[model samples]
Target chain A: MISNEFYSQENHGPYELYSLGDFELEDGGEIPDCKLAYNTFGELNKAKDNAIIIPTWFSGTSKDYEAYIGEDRALNPNKYFIIIINQIGNGLSSSPHNSPDLMSMSDFPNVRIGDDVRAQHQLITDKYGIKEIALVVGGSMGAQQTFEWAVRYPDMVKRAAPIAGTAKNTQHDFLFTETLIEAITSDPGWKSGNYQSNTEIAEGLKRHANIWAVMGLSTEFYKQEKWELFGVDTLDEFITGFLQPFFQMMDPNALLTMAWKWQRGDVSRNTNGNLEEALGRIKAKMFIMPIDEDMFFPPRDCEAEQKMIPGSELKVVHSIAGHFGLFGGEGSYYHDQIDKHLNELLAIPVPDKVI
Target chain B: MISNEFYSQENHGPYELYSLGDFELEDGGEIPDCKLAYNTFGELNKAKDNAIIIPTWFSGTSKDYEAYIGEDRALNPNKYFIIIINQIGNGLSSSPHNSPDLMSMSDFPNVRIGDDVRAQHQLITDKYGIKEIALVVGGSMGAQQTFEWAVRYPDMVKRAAPIAGTAKNTQHDFLFTETLIEAITSDPGWKSGNYQSNTEIAEGLKRHANIWAVMGLSTEFYKQEKWELFGVDTLDEFITGFLQPFFQMMDPNALLTMAWKWQRGDVSRNTNGNLEEALGRIKAKMFIMPIDEDMFFPPRDCEAEQKMIPGSELKVVHSIAGHFGLFGGEGSYYHDQIDKHLNELLAIPVPDKVI
Candidate 1:
C-alpha cells in the first residue's frame, strides 16, 4: 500500500479530515470509514452564519484552492468563514488511492456530484453545527458541486456562485473528459489501474497533460504566447516543466474516479431527468459565472443554465486564459473580475427565515 | 513483420507503385529504393493539359480519396485526368510499417509537406510527362501539400484548392497534433514504437480516436447526435465501429510520422520564414477553402492565409461536421459546395502561353 503521507496534511495541507464511518455511496457501494479532507480560513461569526463552502475541482486538493482565497480576494478569508473541502477521488479524500482494496482503483464505486455535496452537507452540519451556508463558490468541477449544493439542498445553501462550469455536463464536455480518462488508462504501464507506482504510468500522465494543453486553455492562449507568462519559453518547456510534472505527481485512478463523477454531473438526476425542473428547485441566490474563452464550458452554456435557475444572474468572466483564468494566473486580472462578481454576489441581502 | 497486404492494392487499391531509387528527403535523409503509391483516374489527354493532382490526407490512402472521385464529382474522370498520390507516411506508400529495417518505425526519417509535394511533382513529370497541373486539390494534410505545391513550384501548379487546412500549422493545431502523437506513444504496448501488431496498441488507438471525437468534429455534431447519420446509435458504438476501426488498420509510426509533418507544415520555410513572401510566390490561382466548424483549421485562420496569397479566393464550407465534412460524409452536402467551387475555378479560362 502507498503511504498515507501521499494524502497527509503534513505533505499537502493546512487541512483537517472529517471521518464519516462506513459511508454508503450514491451507487449503493460503501466505503469503510469514509473521510473527507478539508481546510478552513477565517472564523465563524457569533451567529455562525458567515460560513461559505468551496469544493475542490477534479484532481485538486484543498491546498489548490488557496490561491483563490486571501484577505482581499473574491473568497476573502477575513469576511467569510471559508471551508474548502477536497472532493472525493482527489487523492486527499476517500479516493481510489487511499480507499480499501475492494473499493480502490478500477473497483472504486461510481461517485456523483450530488454525493460529494451530500458529504459536504454532513461535514458542515455535523462538525460545525452550521444549518445555513452563506454561499458555495467554485469553478470547473468545483462549480459542479456548487450547483449540486443549491439544487440538492436549496434551503441549506443560501447563495451559490458556479464559475466556468454548467449545472449539467454537456455532451461535448462529457466527451472531453472521456478522452482525458482514456489517455491515462490506455497506458500499458497502467496495468488496468493496478500500477505499482505513478512512475510506472509516467507516459500516460504525460499524455494526460498533453490533452490539457489542447483543451484546458483557449486556442488564443497559445496564439498569444501566454506560456511566457508561466515562465516557459517554448511549448515543449511548458509541457515538460508545468503540464507533465503537474500530472505526474497525481494518481491516475484518482483522476479517473473524479472524471467519472465529473462526466455524470447533472442536477437533473435529482429531479427525475428534468434539467429546468432541477434548476427550478434551487432557492439559493445564484450567480452563474463562466469564462468567455472556456471551450469546455462556454459562456453561452452557462447563460442558458442561468435562465433556468429562478432569479439567477449570469456573469461572463472575459479572459484569453480560457478555463485556467479562474486560477488567477498571469497578474490576477481574471481573479479580480471573479472577486468583483463574487463581491456582488455576497452583497445580495439574505431573505428572512421561513417556517 | 506485418504483411505487405496491409499496403497492397488487394485490400485498399486500384493503386500502383512508382519506384524512385535511393530517394533523398529534403531533410537530407535518404530512403533506399523509395516508392510512392498512387492511383490514376482517366487517361491523359493528347494535350496533357487536363491533368489534376490530389494528395492524400493524414492516414489516408489513394483508396480513401475514391469517394470524392466519380463521373459527376468535383474530380470528374471524364473531363480531367486525376492522379491521387498517397502521402509518404500513409501505409499505402513507403511508411514505417513497410520501410526497410534500418528506416522502420521510430527510425523513419521526418517527412514534411514540401517533401510529399516534391515526390508528387516527380511522379507527375517523370512518370506521365505532365509538366503543368490543371489543379492541385486536397483537404487537411493533403491541403498542406496543395499549398506546398502552389508555393514551392508555382510555375507547375496552375491552380490550387486547399481545404480544411492551412499553409502553416497554427500553434493550436500543433498542440492538437502533439496530443494525438502523445496518445499513441504513451501506450505501454507501443514499447517506444517497437510494438508487435496493431492489437498491442489497441488502447492507444482507441484513445487517439477519442481525441478525434472531441476535436475532429464540432460540438453541434454531438448536440445533434450526427453520429446517428454514420449508422451508430451510441457514442460507444460510434467509437468502436467507426473511429477505432478506422485508425487501427494504419501503422502507429506512420500516423506519428504524418502528425509530425502536419505540425511543421509551413510555406514560409520556402521563403526564409517570411510568410508574406512565400505566399506571394504562389503564382497559382488559389482557392483557399476552410471548414467553418473545423477547430484545427477554422475559417478565420484560412481567411488570414487567403489574404497573404496574392489574389487567393476564400471559400468557407459551412458544416457542423467540423473537419470530417471535408470527407463528404452525411449525403455529401459539403462536398457539393466544394464541387461547385471547383467548377467555378475550372471555368476560369487558361491564359495563352507567353513568349
Candidate 2:
C-alpha cells in the first residue's frame, strides 16, 4: 500500500527492466540475467544525438530523479531525450528482495560506480542503438555514476556534471555504506540474505535512515530546521516522524545493494589502482560541484579532484545543507550558484571541431 | 600487535580495571561486577576546590582524553584535581569480553549518559572522596556524560563544558548506533551474544569501527588525510590500516554494550519525557560547544540545548575534523574558547552566600 501510492505518484512514465545477462558482480556472485529498471522521457530525435543519461542516488530510484528529466529542466525533454537508469540491486531492478534464487550476501559482487555505468551502457547501446549522449549529470551516487560515464567512455559524453559527488569512495563513505549493508544482512529475518515475505524490519531500516540524514543536512541546517525538516516538535517526535516516511519508501535489500556498490566505488580500481591515470583518461568537459557541508563528498574532495584532472572546473556550493543541498534546501543559495555554472556550460557553443 | 604497542605507550599509564558490582546493562542481561579501567594524570588539590572531572569519550579509555589534562593544558594538575571516569562498557570497565560468566549480547544494561555520571559519582564520592568539581568536561560520548553531571548533580559542579554532545539521543543517532549493534550482533561468531571466551569476532568489530570513524570525522578530513592518516595508498591499504587496529583493541561485547547505551541515551527518558525539563534541572553554569563541521553532533544539536538551558553560553568551533575535532584536532579552538569563559568564572569573587 504505501509503496503502491508512492509508485503511482512518483513513477509517471513508461518503463522496462532490461536483463543484461548473468554478470559477475564485484562480490564474485553471479546474478543471472541481471536486469535494470529504466524510465524514459522526451522523444529521441532520429539522430539520437540529443540523448542524456541520469542515474539514481543512494536508496533513490529512477523515479525520484526523473523530475529532472522533464520539460524546462536541465535535461529539458523538449530538446533532449532523457533515460533514467536504476542501478542494479535497487528494488525495481534485479535486487536481493526479488531475485529468484536470492543471491548470497557474501557472494554478491563488489559493484563499483563504473559497473553501474557499464551496465547502463550495455542497455543503451544494445537496446536503443544510441551512439552518443548530450550530457550525463547527477548528484550523490548519481553524480558518482556520471563521473564513471565520462571515465569509462571518454568520447561518448558531450559534457558531465557531477554534483555533491566523489571520484572514489573515502573510508568514511565506505564505512557508512558498510554500516547500512550490515544492518540489513544482520537482521534475524535476513537469514543470510534469503528472507522472503517477512515483516518489514522497521528498526533496522529506521536506524539506517537516521545515519543517512545526518550527512544530508549540515549542523547549521539541522539547528535551524530540525523540527520542520523532521516534522516534529521534540527530538523523539522528529525521529519518529522522519522514520515513518523513510521506512515506508526504503527497501532494505535495495539499500544494501546500493551501499555495496557505493563502498566499492572506485574508477581507479577499474584501471589497476591508478586513480590519477584513470581520471586523466576522461575527455568530457568536466564540471564538479561539491556541497560545502556535504559529509559524503565534501567540497575538499572535489578540490582534490579538481587539482588532479587537468582543466576540470570546481565550484564549491557554500551552504549548511550537507550532501542533500545538491538538491534544494536553505542551502538553496548554492543550488542557484550551481545553476549559473551549468548555464554557462550550456551556452558555450558546441565546439566547431570535435577535437 | 599494533594495538598492543599503541596502547602500551607510557601515556596509557598504569592500565587497570576496577570492579563496579555486577550491574544489569541496558539489555536485561547481567554481568558480574563490571570492571572500569581508568588512569589519572593531575593531582587532586588540597582543598579539592580546584578539581576537574574529565569523562571518557565513546570507545575511549581514560587515556584517550588524558592528553588534555597534563601540565600546560586547561586541566593542568599543578592547578587542579582531575578525575577521569571510564564508562561501563568501555572494555577497561566491565564488558562482555573479560567477564567471568559467558555474557549474552542482550544481557548488557543500556547504560545511559546519566548512568555514566551516576557510576562516576560513586567512583569519586566513595573511592576518591571528592565533595565538588570545579569543571566537568568531555567530548562526544564523554561530553554526553559531562552534560549528565550537570543535570544529575547540579550542586556538585560549578561549571559544565559539554562539547560536540547532545543532552538526548536523536533518531539519527539511534539509527547509527543501532546499526552498529546489529553489525556486531550479526556476526556468525556472535551466536546470540553467547560467544564468550572463544575467538573474538574481528570482522564484525572491524565493520563497527569503520562506521564509527566515518561519523566521527568530516568528508573533508577524509579527503585531505585518508591516505596519509592511515599511511596507505590504496583502498585495501586504507581499510586494513584503519579497521585492523580497532578490531584488535576493541572487545566485541564492549562494542555492543556501548552502542546499546548510546542508542538509549535519552537524557529526558530518565527524568520523564521532557528534555527541556531535564536540562532546566541543572544548576551549574553551562557552556555548550558544538563543532560546526561535526556531522554527528552538529552545531544545531548544541544550539537546541543552548536555547533550552537558561543563560547557557553557546560557542561553535569551525573545523573540518567533524566530531573528533572537539578533542584531538582543531578542538583547541573550542578548548581555548572555554578557557576564556573559565578564567572569567574564576576571576569572579566567590559569592559570600556559601551553602
Query: Could you tell me the lDDT of residue A317 within candidate 2?
Result: 69
Weakest 10 consecutive residues of candidate 2 chain A by summed lDDT: A1-10
lDDT of 2 by residue, A199-271 (tens): 4555556556655655566656545554553345665565566644565455565677788788777778768
Q: Kindly give the stretch of ten consecutive residues in candidate 1 chain A with the minimal lDDT sum.
A: A1-10
* Candidate 1 structure quality by residue, lDDT tens digits, B159-187: 89998999988888898998888778877
A1-355: candidate 1 lDDT, tens digit per residue: 3443456666678888899778888888787788998999999887788999999988778887787889978688888899999998889888887877887777778888988998988998888989888999998999999999999888778899998998889888898999888888777788888877878888878888888888888877877788875677887788789888888888888899899999999999998999999999999999899998887787877888899999999988888888887666755777788889888888998786532
lDDT, candidates in the order shown: 0.85, 0.68
What are the candidates' individual DockQ scores? 0.67, 0.35
lDDT of 2 by residue, B115-154 (tens): 6677777777777768777888887887788778888887
Best-performing candidate as measured by DockQ: 1
Off by over 4 Å in 1: A4-11, A99-108, A192-196, B4-11, B100-107, B191-196, B349-355
Compute the interface RMSD for each candidate structure: 1.3, 3.4
